[model samples]
Target: MSAVTAPQADRAAPARTASDDLDVVPLRHWGRWVAALLVGLVAASFLLSLARNPNLDWTTVGTYLTKDFVIRGVGITLLLTALAMVIGTVGGVLVAVMRLSANPVLSWSAWLFVWFFRGTPLLVQIIFWGFLAALYERIQIGVPFTGWHLVDLDTNAVVTPIVAAVLALGLNEMAYAAEIVRGGILSVEDGQDDAATALGLTRAQTMRTIVLPQAMRVIVPPMGNETITMLKSTALVSVIGGRDLLTAVQSVYAQNFKVIPLLVVAAMWYLALTSVLSLGQYFLERRFGRGRRGSAGPGVISRWFKVSAAEGVAR
Candidate 1:
């Protein structure tokens, strides 16, 4: 073998530079700017129209916005929403628990309640409750079929329009809430129940202490949505002569004939209320989302900006 050596490989390498390690900024999306511009233009046009259009009667809207009757109506609307939600949530939790129970009777009863309420239109339910007096002249609290009454009350007196509204809203809400709760419960793993059993926790204790806390992560968002829906649905109470916000506005517009302005007033109040509720829902979701990965943070707006910046740098 001849003593032959391959030529030495090139030892020199390209010089390192800070630029090599630096991130390349991504191009901003053109669509986002376009969309923003379009939205701004539309919003500005709408505002300009509202300012210049005499038919809108912004003065009437402002005048009625803080009127005593309007304020009272708003108060009543909020009261109905709050009370109905409370009643619905409490009843729904019970129904949800029953639905998850081993007892067939309890489960079936819960199911029937849900089926009837959920199947029917809420407007019809409200109407039915309003006219419940016609169906039952009196209600008696006593042993069934015993004819011995502990309390006998006139249905007409008991089921006032407001009471009827509350009952209708609450009962109807219960059906929806039950489903939300049930879904949350089912989201929990079976092993968790077993673990709770091993820990010697009773079913009730397990549900309250272990299951519900975890389920709340799933439950809260939908519950908040339901609350907002319920708030809007309160307007339907006007059909039954319930004096809610819509009714208040209707009462005003009926006389002054400033229907558009009064409606604008109601719309503004509804928007304001829903905005507050949306903020509350955001905080609640954030609170419950703690300890979960990618869950804890400020709102999507701030996070979106952060993510966009990071993407820009990385590109």
Candidate 2:
């Protein structure tokens, strides 16, 4: 081997620096701690105020909290929520498919369905359905242009207030759900459809087995939120006396004049139900998010202090 050149030997070893040790001392997020402390103080104060407020009539809240009527109302509310979601999800899938169909007629019909239902307020729809007898005295199932009434039913008798409530909530949910489903489906790349076709899959089969399962990764989050929203929307059925939680509470408050307490009761139940749904959504997302980056992510404190890969790369 050749002897080291004098010029190379003259260059001193690179000077040591703090970074040379690779000791990455993390920064303390003092601002996050300060903000959290302030928020905690505010929340504590607000809760204290609520506890001290005598006008809330906590006695009434306790009295009717688990009353038979209230329990029945809770059952009815859950029923409405479940039924509406079932109708909405099934109808939504069909409507979404129609909206994406090649035929202009099918597409336009789906569009019109979404536009009309989503355009009108839920209250109007509920009231219209509740009072359908005013517009059409009877609901008749007969041959078109043949005047052969196979079945005839009184509108008032057939479409009860609860039925009207379900119809309104379900149809309205269908409109919004359709858009959510369509958006999720569209998030999938066109290549997916081509791949399915190349594999000899029918359109329906492709949608059911391939695109939809993949699309669920996108669909679940918003659909979860919509479900919670639908649960809350059941309160609107009170206007039509659908015997939901709010309607039952309203009846009690109407008699006792403990409006605030009754309202608090309803709010508590709604909160509890929504919290349960949120937990379900969280677990479902975790399931669908397998193998995705940041799916099961850092905690709030760590996330605040964390650095991005792109930032590290840039450095």
Candidate 3:
């Protein structure tokens, strides 16, 4: 009887293990319900608002869409964005290099640049640049030791609205871009720089040929984000009569008295532009991310990211 019971107990041990594995604990996802309610409320409110406004005459919207003035506004917006990015990238690289330089002057200059630009309001800066031209009529650029006839800086001629926009946006953007670039540069492993130095490459050559290329792989996505942000930031240029999209919209509504509708039109265009930029960013990120294998494509990666983020909250 003891021998038979021992065998039965061994068999029962396996069954108990299986039972434990199969046990279903009650897991509560309380936040999921809360989130669902919030989402539903927001959706309902949007639908109800649109329904009440029923005046969204697509024909009027379509008619205003192709106007030459509006088209020009979009063009100016793109132009300002592009100009700011160019200036930002060049200036950012310089400041980043300066920050990383061995000389204290360069590093302090870079630090001050970032500190001041990042600290001040961009709108105030633009306005200041626009008005400050009155204080200085002309600037004289000359060699320190001898008059080598370097070009003069004509403040009166150069401080136009366009110049003001560029100066304001470009200077402001450089501060942020400098940090972005510096971070990306630092992200490169120390070994790479040491190897380049070992190979007898000058610091500049190593940076240009090796570090920048690799750093770009990290830099492009955030740079793309900055580009998109700069596009929206160009709207602030209108304060200085820069004539970008938002200003154009303001002018149209101010004159036409179709304030809400015209503003909505402006918003629609901004949304459309941002949507296009977002797609470009997605593709750019995908292009940069391609060497890593077994990774999902850009769109799916973004979707999964969003899903995982939501899951974190749900848990």
Candidate 4:
């Protein structure tokens, strides 16, 4: 009777399989749905407001957006931004190297430059540069205190508004770029330098080949941010009569009294320029981030192709 009862119990309770052991409960995220709905509502309200607004002066904005003077101003702004960034980045790299050098004079000089420029306001620098002729009538290049002169420059003729704008923007940008470079260099492991030294590489070679390449991973993001900031900062040149985008808009508004519309046109152009720059920065960051851990992902081209393939597969 015991044997018969045991056999019956075994038959009633079957052996568990892998599928039977698995738990298949779906997760519920009700809060996510609530948050998404709230965001959608807010976005809809903002769009409705923009659509219904009458004071935006869309017609005037469209008229001046591509005006000849505005286009020229944009070209000047791009040129200034490019030249300043190039000069600033080059000078900053040199200063960063000097700051890290063993020589006392080089280090002290670099520090003083950084201190003076960073401590002072950029607007003041621009104003000072604009009025530089008042401070010095002539710039002579020759032996100090000697009558012999190799070159002489008339201050008023040489330092025009555009030149002054570039000088002020580039010099001020150099101070900030130096700090960013120094921070990036310091972020590299000490062992990397030591390893390069162990391999019999010169200081310049090591820095050029190993240290800077690695430092770029840390440097690119902040530099991208600086580039964007520099774009906006170009507006400051308007104070010096440099005729940037904002200045052109102001000039238009001054004649027509369409202040809001002209301002809106300038803002739209700025947004378009910045959007292009931002996309370029994203691609640049991706390029430098190759082979780094956790940096693996579908790039712009890859994502586009992936979507295309999915569509083809569905068809």
**Candidate with more favorable, higher TM-score: 2 or 3:** 2
lDDT of each: 0.94, 0.92, 0.86, 0.91
User: Which portions of model 1 miss their true places by more than 4 Å?
Assistant: 1-15, 18-25, 143-146, 299-315
Error of 3 at 96 (Å): 0.2
Model 1 residue 62 lDDT score: 85
lDDT of 1 by residue, 141-215 (tens): 998998999989999899999999999999999999999999999999999999999999999999999899899
Q: Model 2, which residues run further than 4 Å from truth?
A: 1-30, 297-315
Tell me the spans in candidate 3 whose CA falls farther than 4 Å from its real position: 1-38, 54-60, 139-156, 293-315
TM-score of each: 0.86, 0.85, 0.78, 0.87
Each model's total of backbone clashes: 1, 0, 0, 0
lDDT measured at residue 245 in model 3 versus the true structure, 0 to 100: 82
lDDT of 3 by residue, 1-315 (tens): 335587787877745455666868899898998999999999999988875775765556667777888888989999989899999999999999999999999999999999999999999988988886677767667887796647677786778888889889999999999999999899899999999999999999999999888888778888999998899899888887888888887888788677767666778888999899998987877777788675336577778999999999999
lDDT of 2 at 182: 95
Measure candidate 3: CA RMSD. Answer: 7.2
lDDT of 3 at 314: 100
Better of 1 and 2 by TM-score: 1
lDDT winner between 1 and 4, please give it.
Answer: 1
> Model 4, which residues run further than 4 Å from truth?
1-28
In candidate 2, what are the lDDT values of residues 1-315, reduced to their tens digit?
888887787675566778888978899999999999999999999999989999987888898889999989999999999999999999998999999999999999999999999999988998898888999999999999999999999999989999999999999999999999999999999999999999999999999998899888888899899999999999998988999999999998899888999999999999999999998998888888888887875446556556565577789
